[model samples]
Target: MASRRRLFILLAILALVVGIDTLERPLANPDEGRYSEISREMAASGDWITPRLNGLKYFEKPPLQYWATAVSFSLFGENEYTARFYTAFCGLLTLFATWFTMRRLTNNETALLATGVLLSSPYFMALGVIVTLDMGLTCWLTVALAGFLYAQSDGTSEPTRRRAMGVAWAGMALAVLSKGLIGIVFPAAAIFLHCLLHRDWTLLKRLAWGRGIAIFLAIAAPWFVMVSRANPEFAHFFFVHEHFERFLTTQHRRVEPAWYFVPILFFGVLPWMFTLPSVAAASWLAERERRSFPWRRFALLWAGFIFLFFSASGSKLPAYLLPVFPMLALVIGDWLARTEPRRIALYLLPVVVVIVIGLAIGWGAPERAKSAWTRDLYGTARPFIVAGGLVISLGIAGAAWLLRKGERVVPLAIVVLATLVFVDCVEDGYEMLSPRQSGRDAAAVTRQWVDPSTRIYSVNYYDQTFPFYLKREVTLVNYVDEFALGQASEPRRSLPTVAAFVEDWKRPGSAVAIMQPGLLEEVLKPAGLAMILIHADERRVVVRKP
Candidate 1:
């Protein structure tokens, strides 16, 4: 089993390397992109003590991710790949952690499949490369949850169980450091829901959870104390603003409908999408032998809590539901191992076909396709195009065929995974071949435009990717009227309004402007400001005021 796990670990590392950014592009996405840039800045600034958001003192999340990324950047010189290395590293770790964690609760076949589902999931793949809090949270929670699962698996021996519990608590502490209290809270919720649903309350009674709590506090408290002490406002902002307000109030206005995660949960489990049905089928198949071991029951409860918990929040992003993937993967792994080949193939065929068709259409689409969709997809790769697609398609088809043959399952998984790795590498590598703003190169270009004397402004546009890649401070233009200056972070960097900068542009010799398409027509045209569109892409609008 350990040898099998080592092989899966090797495969997981390959999957991650496939997505690792080789070219530096400007950060284009938001939230994660921007937050990562800020964290990188804080890390590089030698200001390891106080967290800053966009050059201002901002304390939204704990410093663990920032510190990690900064350390990666220090070692790697801080580009998109380096900036995202921490998140991606967490993601990779989560893959290994999930494999071992599932193995504790179930069989080896289940563990292998579960880990595969997680490694190929949409949310996990994307978050792994971007500077996102979700991946960090996912990583820590997975580690903690793995401990939790081990605790349950070792129920026979008190000493073993307690030892597992200690690991669980320490992992929980790391998870909390990754996010906040939610690290422990979410897992606790999963445990409770599992017990209640299964009438396994006796399991909880033996957990000696208080000791676990103490372990969590011990590992997590120092950072909280140091940060709070360093930044006096840390406690209130960390708890009140970031925690409660982010959840209850729409002041951030990120609220979405309750069924929001429904799609994320489905697509986020990609590559393994076909196998999910088998999990449901397997649960039913095992319904008679339903063990007190909280595998399926825990998975169901875990997924439910993550979906509904985030749904109840005042804010939502597609990636917030990443925590639910591990449980879903567990269910998937368990089912795929036990299901009949014919039954399983019936479910997987469509998913494979759709991905291929999507890839084909995306690749053939013209430069002037004019469709907003697939404009930025991985299908239009200029790198190893034929070889990559062949490998990926073969993987999917071969995996399906293996399922049809009712094989021992390891070889098919390896084949399927071999293709997935090639695809990620080829797809991500192709961006380096094209003239587009993504990954980290775009950020490097933006960095050249910035000097101490040059004032930078985005013209009604913001690319989250820009910030992370540039590794420089920038202000996102929200509503840049004259009144907007007061809301700016720095009077020079920000303003009371757009008038302050617009007025400066009139006197500029070489001050730079980043403008979106058709953006300045209404705002600046009326003021007779002639701005030049310098750089343009699906992701960014760069302008220079001559």
Candidate 2:
């Protein structure tokens, strides 16, 4: 009972830390700003059916997260916290689901440890606070996996099995809503691979497909139906272009070597990466005795397959491998519960090496900066980076000493607290880089000069956070990068040429334009357009027609 109480307290503290950090940083573009603005527009426009960006139709991703965030905005009024609340909520919920699932599969000790592993993981915690579809997708995927495991686990009554399968189906449905087809595809493929390897055809027979399919369609189908009916172009764009082309081609411009996720998976788990071999061996050997179900093997298959899937994709990002981390936490948790402190102490050595490497990188970051402005920003951030590294190193050293003293539980606590501090420091440092990466400052300046009647033009580029910060859309001037589909459908929404934008700029009403400073000097100046510089930053220049 005391242990449970302590665990609950620790979790509550971690939750508070995560919640506070979500509000501390401005939204970083282009992903954070892009998603937040989409949600803001969704709330403002009251158009829940079709997702739009900058007041134009945007069907690049599904609308589940946008809906959740929109509802948050309506309740809290738009701000960084509200924009990120759903994602942070999902992250916490994912942690709870992981703990509950592991408790059902193994024991309370393993469950608690598993939850700790996930909470302390840098990548998992980082994504939880950042606005992105990845964490939302990871949350639902974890739920789906948990529900499936519960349904299949030994000693589950028939009624409980049916209900668990229902939960699994609903989770997949919500996953689809969160990020489209991969929600269903990943789980289905993992299950198939599991059954194929084990020759367990009976598990398939027990899946309750008739009821499951109904539940899945009931939750996932309405938005797809409504969006498709409202916009004819959604079907091909969402299904073929977004999923197929995104996976098979590099058209999204996110291509990387196939081994890209290899390092990500290694470092993403952090402090626990060294335990993988032991965890794998222990899980594999232990599952040999369980004839009823090989839960650990199934988890391994799930993580391995998904890692390989994203690694093989033509488009890749570090967050793409987030779904695998929950499964890893489970296996690693089980290993931690049974392993000795001496063996665990051995793992701390590699972590010290990582901390040293991190310090070196943090100190050298300013020197590697691309511009004088960014170099100054990096210089300002260097101390925070060093502080983060020092925090982790000291904690790891203390934890190692505790392990040598045969203390187990307190060492884990030290490490979790240390990692949280490290993450907090890194986030603080990241905010310092916001002057270059975010448009929040520019947006604030633009907000001072413009009213509802002012026409705003984004000439040649778009800073994703600007619209969210300003709470208004800018007209596009010869900018059709991600907005290509939106622009094609609504051609008049964007100005076609610089010459044409200059014509629009000559109109009588108050007008402001945002462009790179280089573009203003080389393009607009050469064209003899008269402008008053409103604000200029390292990344963007906001100007007004005079």
Computed on alpha carbons, the lDDT of every model, listed in order, comes to 0.67, 0.88
Task: Report the lDDT tens digits of candidate 1 across residue range 1-546.
Answer: 677667776776666556664324345455556567766777668988776655666666777888887788778775556766777678778888888887777767787877776665655665666567888888778787777677777345877778777887887788788778788888789888767766777877766678877887888898788877876766876799788988998876677888887767765665566555556656645754665574676667777788898989988887788888877877777776766766766665676676677667656544545655335443455445556555656676676677677763564455547556655655465554344545354545656666767666654555555655555555545544321322343445554356766776777566666655566666776787876665666545666665
TM-score of 2: 0.98
lDDT value for model 2 = 0.88
Minimum summed lDDT over a 10-residue window in model 1 is located at 480-489
Give the per-residue lDDT digits (tens) of candidate 2, residues 1-546. 477648656765875675677565888989999999999999998999989999889998999999999999999899889888999889988998999999998887778888888877888887888999999999999999899999999999989998999999999999999998999999998889988987787789888799899999999999999999999999999999999999999999998999999878877777787888888888878877666788888888889889889988999988899999999998888888888887798998688888788788668879888888889999988888799888988888888889888877678777788888888888888888888888989999999889989999999999999999999999999898889889889998999888899999999999999999999988888888889998998789999877
Give model 1's clash tally. 30
Where does candidate 2 clash, by residue pair?
A: none
What TM-score, over all chains together, does every model reach? 0.82, 0.98
Candidate 1 residue 455 C-alpha distance from true site, Å: 3.1
Best by lDDT: 2
